[model samples]
Target: MLSMLKRIIIGAPLKSTELGEQKLNKKKALAILSSDALSSVAYGPEQILLVLVTISAVAFWYSMPIAVGVLFLLTALILSYRQIIYAYPHGGGAYVVSKENLGENAGLVAGGSLLVDYILTVAVSVSAGTDAITSAFPGLHDHNVIIACLLVVFITILNLRGITESASILAYPVYLFVLALFILIGVGIYKIITGDVSSDLHAPIGTPVAGISLFLLLRAFASGSSALTGVEAISNAIPNFKEPGPRNAVRTLMAMGLLLAILFSGIVFLAYYFGIAPKHEETVVSQIAAETFGRNFMYYFIQGTTAMILVLAANTGYSAFPLLAFNLAKDKYIARMFTMRGDRLGYSNGIITLGVTSILLIIIFKGQTEQLIPLYAVGVFIPFTLSQTGMLVKWLREKPKGWAVKLAINLTGALISFLVMMMFFITKFSQVWAVLIFLPLIVLGFHQIKKHYVAVGDQLRLTTCEPIKPIEGNVIIVPVAGMTHVVENSLNYAKSLSADQIIAVYVSFERVDEKIFEDKWNKWQPDIRLVTLQSYYRSIIQPLTKFIDTVEKKASESNYRVTVLIPQFIPKKSWHNILHNQSSILIRTFLLYKRNVIVTTVPYHLKK
Candidate 1:
């Protein structure tokens, strides 16, 4: 029944040869990979306004300057990542770039930063989408956390189904959201030129908070940098694109960046022109929509599409995290399980891990977008800086074509990303301290995992080992709980092994009459000796394991093997098996690695 349900959710398994068919074309790739960057325009402009609004009256006036700073950084990043896409067409983004040019530790730092960033991207995007929903229908305000978590689960299922399927399902909403925003921007521009819209924009002219200083503008730019969080995803997942993947990926990255620039600039401009301040109940985008289209069909359409694209934005994280994890796993920096693909040819373990981790973040923060935003851009900018620096280093060493031009671009980008990351740390230190603490811990964990895999490989390598040889003989021990067909079946198999001796042992919790069991044993006339053990504390595994150790010690000295043959009863129903004590399973687990000891199971199916 569980297998059928899994098949229904994830679809029937795809053959390994069918993996090549799963690559995405540019159109689908744009939606699946760029949604996070595109949808950030929904709140990115608003984040800038949110910071500037603390000044009371002049907030709208300063928004454009701060937004322009973010745009400059965005331009540098897009150009830098294009180089990343072209140079390392196979993908891995900052982790690969830094690891190759910088060193192994630098690569792990980039990988760990990206891992944290992807998780926060999902959490923050879904929370923002839920905020859009509640803006349209206030009834859902209390259940935002639940709604966000459910959306994460749904996106996780779609991704687990495969890349092609998720792209097909998510592309429509992304395109629709883009179209709606373009319409909003075009109409707003026409209205502004024709004298149809004007505002003597005024915010609460009251006490001035912290004066309008350069520091404040930097803070706003840092907050707005969240819009650029997912731009590196395309470079990270070039392998997911169709053949000529690097070319297609670069094109998609350009398209996504252009869209983000236009949409973000237009939204900030219209919000300032219309005096659309950030409201607790309504978003800046929703407010701009209501002002432009009047609470009508187009307004609700904008709100609906905004919510959808914001929710689907998590698809970007879903698309890249698994691929990055696969790379780390291949390098032995993470678990080997992450290297294995699921039936649908997706990295199922990484997908599930990202989903569960993001859901936990949503729950912990109560689906508050404001709280999660501080934790978002720090992780992304770390990679942005490191990736650009790594590229700059490569240019200096290799001096390829246009190396000087590429070096100039990356140097500026690295400096800007470093400044922004530092601003986030300085301005939002209280909220982001935990992220600062987690980054190094995650890197340490990756190193520990690498060490374990290395030790395991060293122990398992056979280059210096000798050939196998047969043992002198075998002494088999059969463990019996009662006189039943299960016990008889095990004894028959043990006798067929031609062992030097076959000893059947039974362990009892306390003093119990054994006359009836002895009589039954005599009646059966089995040509084997039975030894009974007493346990004062009712610990069955300890007594049984102690006896096995004693037997194994004596057998090992004479070049003999000690085999424990356990009889197990199999019930028809899986749940019914739980009713019986799992002694055989416990015994097998206890002696799994004992020297010169072998454990085997003999199953007797129940008829009832």
Candidate 2:
């Protein structure tokens, strides 16, 4: 029943041979991988105005300059990561680049930061998407957190189904979103050119309540930096593309960057010229749409697509996190389960884990995008800075053809990212303190996991010349509940083994006639010795475990192996298991850790 439900939700199991066929093309890959970066246009420029508006009404005019700065950084990052895609086509992104050019510690830091960023991506994107919905229907505003969590679950299941499947499912809304924004931008530009401006276009700018400082500009820049969060995703997932993976990935990266630049700049420019102010009940983009299209079908269409693209933006995190986790797991820094592929050939464990974690963040932050934004950009820029620095180091060391130009590009990216990261730390220190604290702790956790795996390998490893030690014989002890077919089956298997002795032991809480028990044992004629012990406390496992311990000590003294066979009867239906005694399971659980003791369950299947 459970299997049928899983099949229905996630679809049929896919074959390993179908993996190459699952890769996405440039058009579909752009939609899937770049949704997070593109969707940031829904909120990125707004984040800048959100910061600047707090200082004074006139201060919001500075959003254009801040946005231009963000665009410059985005260009540098696009150039730097295209180089990354070609340099390491296998695709580990910043983590691999830093680890190879830099050292192990730098690699771990980059990996940890990316992990945090991916999780935040899901939380923030979904929350902002929910905000768009609530903006359209104020009645749903109170339930936004619940709505955001449900969206995360939906996207997670889509990704778990397979990469190609999700790309096909999500591509329509992504393209529709881009088209909607383009229409909005083009119409808004034409209105400005033809002087069909809004009624409030010439409203006087408000007086400044406070003077603008360098710190204020930096704060706005830092806030707007969220626009660049998903730019690194393409470099990290080159293998997800079809033939000519590196070439396809770089092309997609360039396309995503170009789209993001135009969308972000156009939105910021329109919002400034139209004099759209940030509002508590509605989003900046929503207001711009209302001003441009006048609440018609076009206005609602823009809102619908914006909400969809924002919600689907979480798809970027779903796509990248599992692959990043696979790389980390391959390096032995995380559990090996993350490295295992499911029936669909997706990293099921990593996908499910990312979903659960982001849901938790959404719940904790109450699904407020502004509240979560403070903790967002810090994780992003850490890896951006590290990736640039790692590439710079690589160029200096290799000095390949055109290395000088590459070095200059990466150097500029590294410096700008580092400065922006420092501004995030300084301006939002109170909110981002937790992320700063978690970065080192997460790296330390990676080291500890690696140390443990290394130690286990050392113990389990064997040399070619090493000789095996032989055991003397087996001492079999079967823990029985009573004389039944299950006991007979266990005793038969024990007798088949070449053992020195075989004994059946039982623990009874109620007093029994010794003479009657012995008579019954003799009547059975099983030819196996039976030992029964009375338990004063009515505890079955404690008394049985003690007997096994005594037998193990004696067996170890003689260099013999001790085997404990637990007999149990199988129920035809899984729900029927609750009707029977579970003492055999308890006995097996107790003897698991005993020295020189091996516990095995002998099942007697019921045809019913």
Compared with the true structure, model 2 gives a TM-score of 0.95
lDDT of 1 by residue, 1-608 (tens): 88999999999999999999999999999999999999889989988888888876466667777788889999999999999999999999999999999999889999999998899899988998898898777898999999999999999999999999999999999999999999999998899899888646543333244568889889999999988989999999999999999999999999999999999999988888888778877789888888888999999999999999999999999999999999999999999999899999999999999999999999998998577677788889889999999999999999998899999999999999999999999999998898767888998999999999998887677864655566999999998888899999999998898989999888876455455565567678468888778878887788888999999999888888999998999997788877988978998998897767898899999887
On the 0 to 100 scale, the lDDT of residue 101 in model 2 is 88
The residue ranges of model 1 lying beyond 4 angstroms of the native Cα positions read 202-210, 465-470, 593-596
TM-score of each: 0.95, 0.95
- Range of the 10 consecutive residues with the lowest summed lDDT in candidate 1: 201-210
lDDT of 2 at 459: 66
Q: Give candidate 2 regions above 4 Å deviation.
A: 198-210, 464-468, 513-519
When superposed on Cα atoms, how far off is each prediction in RMSD? 2.5, 2.2
